[model samples]
Target: MANTPLIQTQGLTRNYPGVVALDHVDMDVKAGEVHVLFGENGAGKSTLISLLAGANTPSEGSILVEGKPVSFNSVSDAQAAGIFTVFQEFSLIPTMTVAENMFLGREPGIGPFTNHAEMRRKARALIDQLGFDVPVTAPVAQLSRAQQQMVEIAKAFHGTPKVLILDEPTASLTDREVDHLFKTILKLREQGVAIIYISHRIHEFERIADRVTVLRDGAYVGTTAMDDTDEATLVEMMAGRAIKDIYPEIPHNPAEVLLEIDRLTSRGVRGATLAARRGEVLGMAGLVGSGKSRIFRAVMGLQPTRGGTVTWKGSDITNAPTRDVIGAGIYYLSPDRKSEGLDLAKSSWQNLNIDLMMGREARGAMIRPRALRTTAAGILETVELRESYRPKAVAQLSGGNQQKVLFAKSFGHDADLYIFDEPTVGVDMGTRAALYRLISDIAAAGKAVIVISSDLPEVLNLSHRVLVMAEGRVTAELTGDDRTEDNVLRNFFNETGETV
Candidate 1:
């Protein structure tokens, strides 16, 4: 990697209506180096990248490209200046084919008409060059999230970009897909492409990063070489405090069974069978599309159950209405919080008190805003969310705070079973620590907690007993010595969903 900088910022700052999203911070990206940005969810990492990509303008300071200060008014201007960013959210049009989306604005043509044949030919060649298993003719809506991620990456290479920004590129990918992405990043680095990478997965930094810049609370912390920093030091730098242990030690004591799924089948799920006890944290591990989440969605009536029986405390509640399931005291947190778990437009306190506000006892009664906030503060405090954030819209809070508010919802109305699906999907380690503590507390209080996660360590360290799901069925139930990684992951490939 060259010492000369391809892109650098001089006191870059961004301000929102009532917040300084990114304080004046200076950073640089040199040619042929993978510079990783590390921070908590609200630490201004996304804000800085957005300003650099020209999706938003800075409230102060300037951005320098090749040591020349350049003003970018739009993403087009940034792209024209050899900068490209693939944000975490997919930007492709759903109805368009992969080939069409790859060359959306700059379509190949003969005279004034588009040359569809030539466009597909180049698209196919590019996908094959990247070694991604994607069909160029398939519509973007029809492809899985991983395949769509591949399309987003391939689209960025349409022009020879001097600076490529990737935000959580591997969050939705399988292990094999992540390997392919790592290889692609290395190849790009060898070709002199300066890359700015953002991810919460600490394990990936050692394999891909040349240097790391740590940010906290929207301010600059420091930058250091990957070789010089270990995981403990890096986490401390990102968190601004040394965390002795991220997971809490809680003893598991069994109680009566709270949930039982007998031959449960739903969309993307096979005949799944499982049982949850009141005083245990049951971990579910699987790759994406492994049908771990579908089984519960079926029990909740979010999806139709073809043939199965959902027994809650020995009562047959199969295909029960969602409201009735909630009435029976089951809280299910959706993986996609923005669309399903929360009403982003509402204030934090309002969302936190939604279940109580709509409960039968309070249906026709008047609600006092001040009293509601006062009541909400007690619940929010348990999850470590501040009081000042209670009145603001949930959309304005950081991702960690938003997730805390979602977790607090379960506290508003007590439940017998708490089903957290992908509980810590996007938060940093600090927020994850808080959430894990809450889980340990809930389980200690004798509530059934089912944690479904793709992260292996999360399942391994947290669960008292882990149930491995493959192709939508309970393939293996591991306890004690059987919870080793080799034993658990080996069953993921079991096509029959039965222990060999």
Candidate 2:
């Protein structure tokens, strides 16, 4: 039985109270192969992984592991069966150290005492193997988002798993880290491991996926070899439609300067000067930790400015609190959606109007719950959020839906100047197009928009003018003929001494 499939699912289905998450799906993975699951948000990819990893039970299906039918009632059972998973949402305990989190329930022990030294040694070895530099003794909460993601990956690989399910594993990783992960995946594949990879990034499929299976609206679509199917076919299969243009055309009319920064300096930013005008989309491009985010944080008053002058409508607003800036018709959308953008535990209606209810204007006014709900409903409609999901907690919704709520919340402010930081991270292609259209609409309405993104094509297509950052400094400004990916990369590499 050398050719026997490592894992197989027949008629797999999952159901929530009011939703059919997965419906009569059939899939299989061969030993020593990467089987990618491609689908949009809310298309049942998460449900499939959750069932396979024993985080959730399938309502109806049969799972066969190595030609034998097996049942997993808990994560421990799945682990015992040599199955492990790294989900999109992290599962690490924030209070625990990296080593402790990695070997949480399976810590090395001698008789009745835990072997702390051995645990630390194993954790350090794994981290080094993954090309990560996180300290083993450091708390998970103290690490950066990327570092935390690396820890999650390391934890999944702590034991030699026969089947590894990775859902959006590269969502927070940089290019170098992703390369390291690919190398590790290849090594694991050589050991006859079965990999179930799930991601929305189409470019990654060709590089890492051996076979791809498509799903739509909780139903199985089809499966194809990676070399046989192209990106266009994959997108059509995932979205069930032709998405011609994801980014809208930029408006040519940019009026008088709305917000201007002169020699701004902050904790993570060096001397930076920039200007955003009305009816224009100003794109910011840089690598991670290159200080692009610090500039926006300084403008929004989230970070203290050491020495800078921020002039908005000819008035100095430097060092002003975030609430005051937002009250003045300036809004900032944070990159970290789960932590800073939206409250996951709160309902969509609550998060949609929280800012307005807490604003200075509402301090002395009489509260009206009915009117607030009405207004929140209207905002949700404007962002195209489904009516049924308005009452559900934000955490229950998909990543794309949560992002829509963030946009709806920001749209409720009717701000004149909007700063969006990585607005579409971890979202599907269809949701990305909708967000880009919304951003364009905001700029077309005589509002100033600044979009900071790591995606070079996104910046190049959506910006009327582009600003390149390197090592906390603005390296080059591109407009007209210079607004291209090659030019931006050249500027981005100037300080790093790396070639494009």
Candidate 2 error regions (>4 Å): 1-4, 358-370, 496-500
Q: Lowest summed-lDDT stretch of 10 residues in model 2?
A: 358-367
TM-score of 2: 0.93
lDDT of 1 by residue, 15-77 (tens): 888999899899999999999999998899999999999999999999999899988899899
lDDT of candidate 2 over 306-348, digit per residue (tens): 9979999999999999888888778899888998989999988
Q: Candidate 1, which ten residues in sequence have the lowest lDDT sum?
A: 356-365
TM-score of every candidate: 0.88, 0.93
Taken over the whole model, the C-alpha lDDT of each candidate is: 0.88, 0.88
Q: Give the TM-score of candidate 1.
A: 0.88
What stretches of model 1 exceed 4 Å from their correct place?
A: 15-20, 59-62, 89-100, 127-150, 358-374, 480-482, 495-500
